[model samples]
Target: MPTKTTVPEDHRDDARPQFVLEALREHRHFVMCAHEKPDGDVLGSGFALGLALKAMGKTVHYFLDDEVPRNLRFLPDADKTQRTFEGIDPSALYVFMDMSDRARADDALAAVPRAQIINIDHHLGNKRFGRWNYVLEAEAATGILVLNLIGGLRQTVTEDIATCLLTAIISDTGCFLYSNATPSTLRVAATLQDLGADKDVITEQLYQTRSFSGQKILGRVLDDFVLTDDGICYSTVSQKLLESFGASHEDLEDVVGALRAVDHCEVAALLKESPDGSYRLSLRSRGRVNVMEAARALGGGGHFRAAGATLAGPLADALDRMLTAVRAEMEAERARG
Candidate 1:
């Protein structure tokens, strides 16, 4: 059992965590959720919190709008996540993790009374919509917030909980490669490691283990890659291309990162065609651009270095809109300088 250590100085004065802790202590039932397209940070953070609540003997139900990504399915309790809140306890407190907006959790969550919702997030431009919003924008990941909450509640971080929280931090920080991985973030990760987080398993499953179909899709997307003269790298993965290679959207999860790795690439964008004729855009930046501002302008939101949006597609129109957003942000960055 891992005992609580010194509280991170940055969060020591924030009463939001204490407030959220009280609410969780008061509630007998909880329904945990995150954004629709589940990712490592959201799923791992949600599960860590849910697991802690369950260990306290409270009823916890996990809900998400989509299936867990293949790479993240190895996390404990990943299989138990439900797609709907059907048969949910009306009195259950709703807990939204790693997302700024409730709509990102599910369209149905919008109708739930705001007083019953707790929003825990670390994204920029968060709405703080929860009755108890623990929004620490400077923190590397929402998992860090959850870890603080667990420490505040004086609960031991069991091995499984440690692994889940570590996964959240790892995913959001791009395995500590992203600039967001601050010293405090690394400290939290070290604590989790000491608490027995399986770094080997996480590294193997998240990066090393790639499906054949996923590799094919990656190759195809790279074959069609484009690098604009202005250091904007991009590529498109159409639904037809996915089907031809027998791939799922999960296969392209890291494609944008690959694009972002190119030398001199200031911004990288990958647009994937959806079944509804929309394109899901994943944007990444190398510090020169504020991708979140562009994503927010396009009705999406994330950190400055990584953000996303969905645009209605004729393919050509969607591609144009995405590039326009990136260019605008780049120009804004230059003007700010």
Candidate 2:
């Protein structure tokens, strides 16, 4: 697909740009938010857009429900992010970023006293849950689209903005190692780098650092890792395991990635017990399995290679059911040969 960057500097009939342009025209003071458990993609994209809007002299309230992970604190203006909507005007429009469902925004979104919502996301299963939904099913990350949106708004792309957007793309694409990272993804990365995005700074903060508790949890996961005969590797991060290691949900982000690195592991799954008592499953496929289909079969959504779902626990049974779908998909794919 052609990057929409070279289009004439006028209104195009494209729905994505039209939605963003319309929202900018319609809303002045806006509450920009992300998913409940915020990750780099959502936070980075939301913050980048926030910077762009603020540059235009608009009131932007960056609201996030979850505690920002420790490693991502180096973001230029992330310290200003809010967890509540208090003291802000009730009349502000709400912009949901990197997430489709309002429920994913959690309670922080509930108090927002506006009916107008603009949803910008890159999820395949986004239900178009906004007055204006600018979701791109094929975009690697929302940051990629937000970079285009910044250009759409005809705003200057500052170095700080480039860093935030670059972090979003790198985090979501697993450092451009995931299947979602395409030629266009790299082009965006190259452009961001040219705009002064510091790869060393981002890598130092995100990759070179890991909490002691997180490392302990990784040790446990590796010790108990399971590799089935069918090349399916899985790990567990139950509430009990978390308590034992004094680990937070934030730390398990890379445990699945580590599990995926094992030789001959076609699929890797990390099932963690969420604080809300549901089992959150993060899955990765090394090409032999369609994890997205497996996730959707169990009522979740994401890319073909990386997908996720939160199942109501008892985690044991939910994990079993999810794995059943994954195994079936693997077997079906193998049968296709």
Candidate 3:
């Protein structure tokens, strides 16, 4: 685990300055963005903030590089998300949620050069990549930060906003199962539930739900699971298997989570062959490994336990190299233990 450091506690009243609140009130237009290949937390945090801003009478535009996943389409106002960069006015106040660096901003990075960027994220590896950064590494999710920001508005959080925030919190904290789920996380989640978030509905749609093709692809991946020294387990999903199972990228979304559930697995790896010939690597560690550092070594970044990278090469070579690196890191961690 990464070393924990104490920062100022994030309270609703102390979270914002009077000047920042005045600046937000004066701003008429805002653009909210999330990282590339956004997960539930990124999407949920971005949309929740956008909705809160809109409720404050600010004209808000939500932007994403990739399409929102089908499961998250239930978020209110998701139809308003902008996927293209053309004709975007750079004058708007840019609010980036759950993104660590400008590179992960995808199409919206161009707008960052001219816009006043405010970054809100939970990743410890965040680069503070905004003109105004509000990073809380100890916070369980960016949605928690969004909730704090909304508290400054003094407006009641609606059901839609609550649902979005709930999804973000639940996903990022692995449904409150990950080690990062602090007492504050439960407090925030309980607050959202009181505000009308149906935890059962969110879990059913996000976790229990899976397409037939998705199930088949997951089965295939599990069948191919390989365990190495030090309890590192990995599986590779090739393009051929995807076609044979009538699965697309969406169908493989939960494969990494499934791999993480295997008993005795200290680390889980899922390598998917992208259509562009690059390999998409998702790494999950069970509290003993820092996958973010390993991912950075391969030119990618994310949280400690969950990080990913894309490698350009044959799938076999990429997987072999990643596993070797993981083995070295796990061995070092075991020695430390």
Candidate 4:
């Protein structure tokens, strides 16, 4: 893929000037938000942007619909994030990072309807739901875009900002192992390191730290992994199983990836029981699958390799619908081959 300019296409019409810095300077009382069940990039990018804006003497609020994972608690200012939109004024400018669509922000999306929405994301399926959208399809992590936006403000990349950016880059790139990672991504990592991002601390806190309940849930999910079409693997955790383990949704975070790691598996599906009695479906794909399309068909969205959606029905019914879609896509790919 060819390298494209960082400037968004919508901004190209302006002959005089066009850049994120101009937009940032215009807005006050900013609210930074990320998607539900945020991973590293979502949390990291949001925090880094918030910190930078604060450094510039701008009032900023970071909002997330879900609780931050325990493992990511080490990120600077993680404790400062607001998980609810109770008292937030809708007049504040809303900047969404990592999430592709308004639905990903859940109830928080409605809290700031009239506010200027700036969509910053790397997901190919992004809906660009912002007054000023800066979607970078080639960037490995949304943090990279956050870094770019704060360009010339190199002095703003404080220890806190660097830590958050590093977390986002490492998590989104699978610790620099994913195909999306480029030489630029590595360079960004090095720069972040120089600014005081401790790789050992981040790795130890993120990958090495896991609750006992989380590990147990992962093991249980793996024990029941089922392979389909000799290439797809899947696992399901019922409400009963969760209750038996005294585990919440957070404990099952690693289950989907474990299923995807099975030998000969090109795709993995983890069907989890949500609190509302609906099924939350998470799908992961190897290089050969496009799980994002499958997730969108089910009224959810995410990246090509990792996507998710919710289904209001019995777990069995939802799993059947998901598998039917996956099987058809797999067959189509096979036919093309």
- Give the best candidate by TM-score: 1
Q: Write the per-residue lDDT of candidate 1 for residues 251-324, one digit (tens) a residue.
A: 88788999998888999999999989999999999988999998888888888999999899898998888889
What TM-score goes with each of the models? 0.93, 0.90, 0.90, 0.90
**What tens digits encode model 2's per-residue C-alpha lDDT throughout 163-211?**
9999999999888887789999999999999999998888787777888
lDDT of 3 by residue, 1-337 (tens): 1233332222222233342344456678788887776778988888887888888887888877678888888888778888775545656778878877777777646646523777778787777665556778888898988787777667679999999999999888878998888888998899999999989988988888998989998888889898875778899888888888888788888688788888988889988888888898999998788888778878877788988888877877898778876777777777889
Runs off by more than 4 Å, candidate 3: 1-23, 85-90
What number of clashing residue pairs does each candidate have, in the order they appear? 0, 0, 0, 0
Global lDDT of each candidate: 0.86, 0.81, 0.79, 0.79
Q: In model 1, which runs have C-alpha deviations exceeding 4 angstroms?
A: 1-15
TM-score of 3: 0.90
Give the per-residue Cα lDDT of candidate 2 at 276.
77
Candidate 1's displacement at residue 271, Å, is: 1.0
Compared with the true structure, the alpha-carbon lDDT of candidate 2 equals 0.81
Please give the ranking of all candidate structures by TM-score, highest first, separated by commas: 1, 2, 4, 3
